[model samples]
Target: MELYFLGTNAGVPTLQRNVTSIALRLLEERRSIWMFDCGEGTQHQVLRSPIRLGKLEKIFITHLHGDHLFGLPGLLSSRGYQGGTSPLTVYGPPGLKAYLDISLAVSQSRIPYKIEIVEHTGGTVFEDEGFKVEAALLEHRIDSYGYRVTEKDSPGSLNTELLKSYGLKPGPIYGKLKKGEDVITDEGVRICAADVVREPKRGRIVTILGDTRPCSGALELSLHADLIVHEATFAHDLAEMAHQYHHSTARQAAELAQEADAGQLLLTHFSSRYSSFEELIPLLEEAELIFPETLLAEEFSAYPIYRRQNGQLGK
Candidate 1:
């Protein structure tokens, strides 16, 4: 799986950064891409990338903030124009339905596909055969939420050598064995799948938080995550301002990652005040003092999720 940062800036768009938007590329697992928080000009950002607008199957909004969801109408309209006939599901907190309705009405946008809006109340918002998505209410000015996305465990691979040793030729029987079925061989010997297959590979966990201050919900959502994407709307020195605005500082985001024991922490939603992103290094270093896998987020950057040798998740 790969995470593509379409927009990483906080609040408003800047010359160097756009608003908050992220694309979770699941082409390896699924044929579609899942988008999180379509900020202003999000479709424009997608146009610049290799992302296909027709392939956007799911959208998860964190909050009603303009920076987080202003691009909904435009994206939906463009999806229709791009011949997206498949139904698309969007999940968010309450009031999202009204927001999209008003925007579509005002802009006179027509959608050719079925759009399903699911306004949840902080729990398991979505689940399918491939993945499960849970949400937790966050401490933001508005009713915000953070999302935890857990991919389902994949089936174990069949041991070809073991199968050959058992005189089982490779064919449809191999497929059945991989599916964990007991089959009787030509020699009248019963072969159990468990004895010839390895353990199932663990799925990757990715947690993405909306704009919020340091809170218990954030920590809970990020616990043991392979990748934690949290908003850092301010620097460490602006802790008071961050608290007042219900936004997190870079150092605070790092601390939460360390507390949650996340494998990697990605800091985004940067304020436009800082012209140079290099200023966040010291703040990230402060967090690395506790968790060494802290990283600063950049616009249009892609982070790959790697599986470790021990069947655990890495970076």
Candidate 2:
């Protein structure tokens, strides 16, 4: 799993950052990509990256803000023009269906693929064999939501050496053994999967928040996550402005990461006032003091997720 930031700015696009959009790359696991918050120019942003528009299987919107979902109509139309045949599912708060309906009707755009929309009310919004996605309401101007993505654990590797020690040769039988099936050989010897396989490996977890102020929902969604992506639309000194605008400051984002015990915190959704991202470093350090692994999200930046080695889960 990996996260590729297409746009990181809040409100509007700037010379340095665009609007809010993120791509969760799951090509290795599911041969598809999931996107969150398709702000303006998101389709254009994806054109510059390696991500394929046809591979976008799921889109989760945080709110109805123009900065968060203004690009959906264009993206959906573009997907049809690009020959996307797979079904797409979109999840968001109420009025999402009306929003899409109005956009498509006004533009006279007809998509060839099936598009399913799920209007959520802050709970477990989606679940499949590989993963589950939950949502919680956040303190924002509108009914905004934060998402928690939990990937299901994968089966462990088969102990080939252990199998060989039991006088079993490597063959299709090994495949059955790895799948936790007990097979009897021609010699009347039964082999159980657990006898030759290690324990299952734990899956990775990632939580991403939309525009909001400091709230318990953010912390609850991000609990013990491998990566927590939160909005930081302002600096710490602009706490009042952040609250007024229903946005979070860099320090507040850091504090949420620390409180949630997240493995890493990535701050994004920067305002257009500052041209230089260096100004947020000191504020990020305040978060780093509590949660050492803190980073400021950058446009087009990719964060790869690797399997944790043994004895590294809690840390």
Candidate 3:
């Protein structure tokens, strides 16, 4: 899995950053992409990146903030115009359906495919064979939410060499074995899947949070996550201002990640005051002081999550 940062600025757009939008691409696992937010100019950002809009299957909105959802209407329209026939599902807080309904109706937009809008009130929002998504209310001015995505463990691969030795050529039998089935070979030899199958690969967890102050909900969602994408809209010294505005400072985000024992912390939704990389480095440094594996989200940048050779997750 990989993440594409489309926009990273907070509240409003700046010359260097747009707003809050992220794409979690699961092409290898599911051949589909799930977006975290749809800030303004998000479609334009997709055009500039390698992401294909047609592959977008789901979008999760953190809140009803304008900067987080202003681009949804246009994106849906364009997807229809571009011949996206596959159905799309959008999960967000309450009022999301009404907002989209009015926006599309007022613009006279026509979508060719079916769209499912789910306004969840903080619980298990989505679940399928491969993944599950849960939401929790965050401490923001509005009812903002944090999402936790947990991927299901993958089955172990069949031992091809061992199968060959036993005269079991690759075919349907391999598929059955991979599914942990005990099969009797044509020669009347019974083989257990566990004898030839490796250990199951561990699943990954990712937590994405919206605008909010430090809160228990954030910690719950971020617990032991492989990647924690948290907003760091202010510097360490501006903790008061960040709390007053219902946002988190870089230090606070790092502290939360540390408390949660997360593998990595990605800081995004930066304040526009830090316009350049030089100005933002201080915030990154402050976060690194608390969480050494912290990284600043750069617009249009892609971060890939992979398992290391030692059976550990890394980004």
What stretches of model 1 exceed 4 Å from their correct place? 308-315
Q: Residue-wise lDDT of candidate 2 within 92-129, one digit each (tens)?
A: 99999999999999999989999999999899999999
Shift of residue 302 alpha carbon in model 2, Å: 0.6
| 2 against 3, candidate with superior TM-score | 3
Worst 10 residues of 2 by lDDT: 306-315
Model 1, range 136-247, lDDT digits (tens) per residue?
A: 9999999999999999889989999988888878899998988899889888999898998899988888999999999999999998888999888887888999999999
Candidate 2: which pairs clash?
none
Q: Write the per-residue lDDT of candidate 3 for residues 18-57, one digit (tens) a residue.
A: 9889999999989999999899888888889988888989
RMSD of 3: 1.6
Q: Each model's TM-score, in the order given? A: 0.95, 0.94, 0.95
Query: Model 3 segments beyond 4 Å from truth?
Result: 186-188, 308-315
Candidate 3: what lDDT? 0.92
Candidates 2 and 3, the one with greater lDDT: 3
Q: 135, model 3: CA deviation in Å?
A: 0.6
lDDT of every model, 2 decimals: 0.88, 0.88, 0.92
